[model samples]
Target: MRKEFLPFARPSIGEEEIAELIDTLKSGWITTGPKVERFTAEFAAYVGGRFAVPVSSATGGLHVALLALGIGPGDEVITTPMTFVATLNTIVHCGAVPVLVDIDRATLNIRAEEIEKKITPRTKAILPVHYVGQPADLDPILEIASRRGVAVLEDAAHAVGSEYRGKRIGCFPTTSVFSFHPNKNMTTGEGGMVVTSDEAVFEKASLLKFHGMDRESWKRFAKAGSPRYDVALPGFKYNMMDIQAALGLHQLRRLEGFLVERERLARRYDEALAGVAGLILPSRVPYPVRHAWHLYTPLVDIDRLTIGRDRFMAELKARNIGTGLHYTAAHEFSYYADRFGWRPEDFPEAHFVSERIVSLPLFPGLTDGDQDDAIEAIRDVLKAFRA
Candidate 1:
């Protein structure tokens, strides 16, 4: 057993990030200043987005994006049940109902064909999550939304560097929101970005993110600016800070290197874990795309073992190998269950994967020795727990 405990994820922070943050602090203008502006512009260019609005979190970004598109009370948003509850919570906060479509068990993404069947007159948008950094089939989903006169919002929280069909994610005609949390591919401490090509949506989202103020803080307080500002509408305080963007500026520059390292570790896991007893590895779709490999989640085959998923995780923990549960089925939560009267069988694929899924460690800084230790630990646990 290893003497050190290995975490499921860790940010790859470097000296450049630290230096930029120190510079921002010494500049005496920390809250949403020049750093934030530069990061937003660079990020927009990187993602090929016409506009990018920085926010406090991905959850906040989703809320603002939904409101920007005029989604609200009595409206329905179609999404997958296999994602984090924030996806459903944001819709509920907007007084919109979340209509869940079961995920494809292999890809863990919402099925495009099944989406149309759930669309009603009240359906305003389709929010497809790029599950585990693999982009959901977008072409068909976009066609359905266009034909139905509804919108599409991408939950790209786990897909910072992912690509689908020869194009990067945010470059598409629709909108996408990406997370910059510590565990994500890159870190801005805790921040997110809403990327969109729609000029109208961008304008509305910008207004909604920073307390509905007509002028941003940096502009209002600048030498050639007026201090007076006006609030056009009620909005939340969800703007990303300059301090956060300080780190983001450097992190963005190093993202390509981070992606290469993550892919290397993920492929190592695949080679070691393939056909391993009491475990089912993640599957790839039959299309041309680049998976960001944010999390290398596998199903613990509980039926073949004396231990259940939780117990299996406990066994790994005992060996000092940490794990993570990316999500439980959204419908299985008490709030959604009580509100929608949903049962596990309502979304069978999501339910099955929810019960069995476990995220093993996969991070940019994970060394080969660390990964080998984790792999050996998993095999040991499976061998001991085999029924």
Candidate 2:
């Protein structure tokens, strides 16, 4: 057994990130200011987006995107139940109904075919998440949305560098949100960005991001300017701070390299876990695009396993190896079940995958020896606990 504990994920912060953050602090402007603006512009270029708005988190981005799209009460947004609750919560925050479609068992993404079935006159948008950083089959989804005249608001929190076909994840005419959480493919010390090609949504989301403060504030509060400003609309205080953007600036610069390391580690996990009994590795997504490999999640085959997912996780921990549950079916949560009258059987694929999925330790900072130890621990646990 290894003599130390390993976390499921860890941020790969470097000297450059620390130096940039210090520079932001020393510049005497720590809130939303020039650094934040620069980060947004640079990120826009990185993803080939026409506009990018930095926010406090992906949840805030989603909330702003839905609001900017004019999704409100009586509107319905189609999404997946395999995603984090934030996706559903943001739809609810917009006062719109979140209509969930079951995931494709192969991809763990919202099934594009099932989407058209759920559309109604009230369906105003299709919110699909790139589950586990694998690009959802988006051409069909986009075509459906176009034909239906409904917007596509992608929850791309797990995918910053991911692409669909030849286009980047956030480069479409529709809006998409990317997370910069500490555990994400790259860290901004907690932040997110909204990318869009639609100028109208971009303008509205910016105005709604910071208490609806007009862009004139930057001019008004200048060295020689007036202090007058106007609030165009009621908005949330969800703007990203300079400190977060300072981290983001460097993170984005290093993201491509980080992704390279992430992919290498993910592939190593695939090879290491191959033919391991009672475990099913993540798929290599048959889609024609690059996977950011944000997570290396494998399903624990309970039918062939001796222990339940929870027990398996506990055993991994006792051996000083950590693991994570990417998600439990969102609809099966008590709040959603009670509020929407949802049941486990309502989405059989989501329910089954939720119970078996576990995110093993895979990060840029993870050494080959660390990963080897993790593999051994998993094998040991399976051998010792096998039915």
Candidate 3:
């Protein structure tokens, strides 16, 4: 067994990120200033989007995006049950009902085919997550959204550099939010960005990210900026600080390299664990896509393993190998279930995946030897549990 506990995920920060952070602190202006602007611009270019609005977090980005789209009490936002609670939480926060659809068994993403059946006249948007960095089947989702005149707001928290059908996930005119949480594909400490090509939505989202000010509230006190500002709408305080953006600016530059290392590690896991008894590895879609490999989650066959997912995690922990539950079915949560009367059977695939999924240690900084240690630990756990 490895002498030290292997964490499920860790941020890879180097001297460059530290230096940039220090530079931001020394610049005297820290909250949502030039570094934030530069990060937004670079992020916009990275995603091939016309505009980017950096925010406090992906959850904040989702809130602003829904508000920008004018989603309110009567609106219903369709999304998946396979994602983090924030995916559904933002819908409720925006005064909209969260309508969840089942996930595709292969990709663990919202089943695009099932979306049409669930769309009522109140359905104002389809909020699909690029689950675990695999792009959701967006072409059909976009087609449905276009025909229905509903918005498509992607919960791309795990998909920074992910692409679908030769096009980047966030490049579309519709709104897409990317997370910069410590455990995400890249780090901005704790930040998020909303990307879009639609000028109107961009403007609305930008305003919503601040205090609903017509112009950024941060600029109002600056010598060159106007002291007067207009509140176009009631909005949340979700703006990203320059301190966070300082890290993001450097992280964005190194994103490609981060992705490369992630892919290599993921392939290594696949090769090492392929056909392992009681394990089901993640699968890729046939479309031309570049998966960002945010989390290497695999499903355990409880019946074959003679123990459930919780026990498996405990066994791994005892062996000093940490694991993570990416999510339990969002709809099956007490709040959602009580409020929406959602049952486990409502979305069978999502419920099943939720029960079995476990995220292994997969980060840009994970060494080959670390991976071997993880595999060995897992094997030991399985064997001990079986015995």
Candidate 4:
């Protein structure tokens, strides 16, 4: 065992980000201002989106996006049970019912064919997450939503640089939300962005991202500013701060490089762990796509091992290597079960993926030596139960 513990993920922050943050703080405009504006513009350009609105976090962005889409009580949002709970929480907060669908066992994303079976008159939107940074099969999902006149909202919290069919995830007309939390591929400390091509959705989301101010309320405090403002609608407090944007601006500039390094590291993991007995590696689809590779997850075949997934994690921890469970099936949680009457087998694929998935170390800053160490540690842990 190594003397130090290796974590599953860590933000790659450099002096540039620190320097930019210090400059923003010393400029006496720490709240949302010039830095936020520059960051938003740069982000829009990076992802090829028409407009981008920064917010407090992905959860806040989803809530505001649904509200902007006019999704409320008596509405249903089709989504997968394999995503983070925030996906379902946002729907409930918007007063909409979450229609659960099974995942494609390979990609662990909501299956496109399964979506049509769930659409109803109350269905207002189809929300799909790019699970673990692999873009969902959007062509079919888009076709169904378009035909049914149902809006499509992308929960791209795990996929910032992912591409679908040669187009960036946010480049199209759909409303997409991204997360900048510390554990994600990029970090703004705690922030997110909402991108859209629809002028009406862009206008509404930008206005409502803050306190429903006519324009960005941060502008009201500048030298050339208006003293009064009008509230056109009731909105949440979700605007990103200049402090957060300070980090995001530098992060955006380094994002492509970060993604390149991440790809290299993920490939190394694939090469090192390919066909290890009783371990299922992350799947690669035949369709053309660019994966951001936020987390390289693989499932453990517990039946072949001596212990359950929890004990496997503990064993790794003993060797100073940390692991992460990306998620648990949302429907299996007590609140969801009691409310929706969901059984463990309602979505069999989700339940299977949820119980076995384990996120290993995959980040831009991890070196080849570090990866070798992780592979060795995993091999040692699995040797005891190799069938």
Candidate 5:
């Protein structure tokens, strides 16, 4: 057994990040200010987006984006069941209904063909999640939206560096919200960005991000600015702070290298675990994409084992290996079930994946030796648990 436990994910913070953070602390302007502005601009340039708005979390970004797009009461937003609850919760908070779509078993993304069938007169937008860093098939989804005169918002929480066709995710025509949580490919400590090409959406989201202030509120405290400000509308407190941007400035610069290392680790897992009995490894979509490889989730064939998925995770934990459950089917939750009257059988593929998925260790800091330890531990657990 390995002497130390391996965590499922960890941020790769360097001396530069620490130094930048210290500089921000000593600069005496810790709230949202110059650093946040620089990070937002750099991130926009990096992803080729026309506008970028920084927020406290991806959930916040989603909330603002939906409102900016004029989605509200009686409106319906199409999304996948194989995602975090935040995707559904944000829609509900906007007084909108979330229409669940089934996922492709292999790619674990929302089925594009099935999406068009669910569109109704009340359907306001299509929100597709890029599951585990792979971009969803957007060409068809976007086509459907454009033809139908509805909007498309991408839940790109797990797709910071992911690419669809030849362009990066944020470069697309639709609005994309990215997470900068600690576990994500890049971290701004705890922040997110909403990137879009629509000028109206960008203007509304930027204003709504910081209490609906007329302009950049941080400038009010500067030497050449006025303390007076006006609120055009009531909005939430979702602006990203300068303290968080201190980490983001450095993280954005190193993101490309981080993605390269993560892909290396994922390929290693693929080569080592291929054809391993009782394991269903992740598969790529047929279309061209540069997968960010945020999470290496594989399903355990529990029918061939004595224990269920929870116990399988417990076995790995006992052997000094940590794992993560990326999500449970959104419809399976009590709130959605009671509100929408959904059943586990409604989306069979997502339910199956929800019950079996396990995220193994995949991070820039994970060494090959560490990977070997994880692989060995997994094999040992399967051998012991085999029915």
Candidate 6:
């Protein structure tokens, strides 16, 4: 048994990130400034996006995107219930109703075929989450959105480096949001970015992200600038700070390498757990898209296993191995159930997957020995449960 506990996820911070953060703090202009602008530009270029607006969180980015698109009261946004609560919460925050669709059991993403049936006059957009770094089937969703005149806003919180078909997740025709949370493929220490190819949406998001300031305060307060600015409309204070952007600048530079290491570890987990009974591993689509491998989640077969998901997780913890629950059915949550009148049967696949899913430890810095320890722990737990 391992002597120390392994966390389900850990951020890989290096000397460059530390030095850049220190430089930003020492520079005295730590709010949304040069570092933030540079990071946004570099991130935009990295993902082939026309514009990228850094925000406080993915939830904030989603809210700003909805605001930019004018999604409000009486508007309904179609999304999947298999995603994090923030995916649904942001729609409600934008004063729009969150209508859920079931997920494809194999990929754990929203069922693209069911989207058109959910479209109504009140339906304003399709919010597909690239669950666990795997890109959702987007071609059909885009086609449906185009024909129906509804927007497609991707909740790409788990898909920073993921690609759909040949293009990156954030490089699509419509708007998308990418998170930089500590557990994500890259870290900006609690930040996100909104990417868009639409000029009107870009302009609206830019204004909405910073207190609706017509001119950014950073530019106005700079050496060769005017001291005044105007507010076009009421907006939220969701801009990313320079302190966070300083870390993001270096993290983006190292992102590809980080992704490579994560993929390696994920493949190792797949190999080690390949024939493990009572476990269903994640699957990928047939297209030639790169998966970011944010979480190496596998579903436990409760009918075959003696212990349920909760007890299995506890056994792993007792053996110094960590695990995570990526999500439960968002629609089944108390608030959504009461407010949206959602029942468990509304999204059967999401509910089924949610009950059994467990995120194994998979990060850039995880080692083969660490993985061996995790596998051994799981094996021992299963043996004990079966005994």
- Each prediction's RMSD over C-alphas, in Å, is 0.7, 1.1, 1.2, 1.0, 0.8, 1.0
The clash count of every prediction, one per candidate, is 0, 0, 0, 0, 0, 0
Model 6 / residue 112 / CA error / Å = 0.4
Q: Quickly count the clashes in candidate 3.
A: 0
lDDT of 5 by residue, 1-387 (tens): 988989999999999999999999999889899999999999999999999999999999999999999999999999999999999999999999999999998899999999999999999999999999999999999999999999999999999999999899999999999999999999998999999999999999988888899767679878899999889878889999999999999999999999999999999999999988878899999999999998999999898889888998999999899999999999999989999999999999999999999999999899999999999998998889888
- Model 1 clash pairs are none
- List lDDT for all candidates, in order: 0.94, 0.90, 0.90, 0.90, 0.94, 0.91
Runs of candidate 4 exceeding 4 Å displacement: none
Instruction: Identify the runs in model 1 with alpha carbons over 4 angstroms from their true place.
Output: none
Q: Which ranges of candidate 5 are over 4 A from the true structure?
A: none
lDDT of 1 by residue, 1-387 (tens): 978999999998999999999998999999998899999999889888888999999999999999998999999999999998999999999999999999999999999899999999999999999998999999999999999999999999999989999788899988899999999989899999999989999989999999899899789889998999999888899999999999999999999998888888888999999989999999998788899988999999999999999999898999999999989999999999999999999999999999999999989888899999999999999999899
Clashing pairs in 6: none
Clashes of 1: 0
Instruction: Select the stronger candidate by TM-score from 4 and 5.
Output: 5
Q: Please give, for residues 1-387, the per-residue lDDT of candidate 3 as tens digits.
A: 788999989999888999999998998888988889988998988899988889999999999988888898979999999999998898998789989889987789888999999999999999999989999989999999999999999999999999998888789868999999999999998999999878888899988888788877567877888989899888789999999998998888899999999999999989988877777899998778999999999888776777899999988888788899999989889999999899999899998999999999999888999999999877776666662
lDDT (10s digit) by residue, model 2, range 1-387: 899999999998889989988898898778888888899999999899988889999999999999999899979999999999999999998888999999988789888988999999999999999998999989899999999999999999999899888788988878999999998988788899999878889989998998998864555777987897789999898899999988988889999998999899998888888999888888766778889988888998778877899999999999999999989989999989998999998999999999999999988889999999999999898777767
Give stretches of model 2 more than 4 Å off. 216-219
**lDDT (0-100) at residue 242 of candidate 6?**
96
Worst 10 residues of 3 by lDDT: 378-387
Return the TM-score for candidate 5, rounded to 2 decimals: 0.99
Q: Which ten residues in a row have the lowest lDDT in candidate 1?
A: 43-52
- Flag clash pairs in model 3: none
